[model samples]
Target: MKVSFDPDVAMLLRRVAPAGVVWVLLALPSQSVYADDYPCRVALCVPSPTNPWSIAACVPALERLFDDLAHGRGWPTCEGSGVSMNYVNTPFDPCQGGLNEAGPGAWVIEGKKQPNHPTWFYTDPASYGISPSASPQQSAGGDAVANASLACVGKLMGTYRTYVGQYNRDYQEVNVAVYDQIVWQKPQSPWAIDVYQNGQFSRRVHWK
Candidate 1:
């Protein structure tokens, strides 16, 4: 008998190939098979260019996350209470006086969306102790900070996939918007990630 399979299920079977053959055979095809063909959209929220993190760090980290997801490394899970995002804090002087150094700089993975709505995964920044002038010793000149930020992006990517899969299974057009407001120290500039259901990345939109 001929059987139908959703794109995501096909992808999953491909991941575990030979070992998953039996499972794939046993799995039932989606009730609404036509839904998996629709396009999937994604958005990224960016902080103002004035924030060093946005230009010098966050962008690259985000790019890395997208590249990894496109290549298929699987997404991260958001099941616990602790913060799943990472950031690098840099001290900023608002009044131009060094006497009172206020922490107002950070680069982070805000969160992803499910279909057309936002699904926040990283909610507790304070719990992570994000502070300006805080640098990972192992990073040795921003490497550690960048890695941490990338890790956070990776987790966010996982969440994005979960939402995308749901939309695809439902045969609904996927609209994902990632918002970046985790850094209160800088102005927020949102961006987006656009991709088709066939795994084609459309474009990255940077909002003014």
Candidate 2:
């Protein structure tokens, strides 16, 4: 049988293929998927190498994040209790700062998406001083099980990484990171966040 997958899913499968992972396709229902929705039906509409800020759902939060990064603002949070998102340049460090500071790594964004919508978005990453990678090594999970997403893309100028685990029934949060020219290392405790379905996030403790 012929089966298709989201760009993020397809990329994940390729990356995990070396581990001998068996691919299984499950039928999902069409609904308003986001961090704020209950029984969260998250559909990752943004694709890697593209600025998530362009997505209608991700505009608000991502725009805020970009602003914070540009101004050296503290960590940004989502709309929910005990939920926040952090952007760090170094791995495993609570000090969230600009990706240009890290000096080595790639910034990426991985997630699930509605099968009907194409992963590509007409967004400009250059505005954030971020460029696309022909082949990105960093990746994350987007299955319903995780009910979350991640981003680890870019180059020394700005490498990104994050893991958005399910925060609660009301919302979800993401951990975004950027690397420099060195290498990509997983964070010790990726920032925790709680996000609503509308793309709004909360700012909590920063890692600077």
Scored by TM-score, the top model is 2
Model 2 C-alpha RMSD vs. true structure (Å) is: 22.4
Query: Could you give candidate 2's per-residue lDDT for residues 1-208 as a string of tens digits?
Result: 5566656545534532224334432112223332233111112212212333333443444444556656876654322222323344322322233332221322243222224533243123332334454223323333322322233233423323333334565243333332333223344334322332333442222222
TM-score, one value per model: 0.17, 0.20
Candidate 1 collision pairs: 35-171, 42-193, 43-192, 43-193, 44-191, 44-192, 45-191, 75-158, 76-158, 139-144
lDDT of 1 by residue, 1-208 (tens): 6665545444433432333223323233342431221111011112111321243222443454445555765332222211122122333112221222112121233443335433354233322333434321111123223322111112322212212125446433222212332222222232333222223332232332
Off by over 4 Å in 2: 1-54, 90-208
Kindly report which residue stretches of model 1 are placed more than 4 angstroms away from their true locations once superposed.
Answer: 18-20, 25-208
RMSD of each: 23.5, 22.4
Model 2: residue 129 alpha-carbon error in angstroms:
44
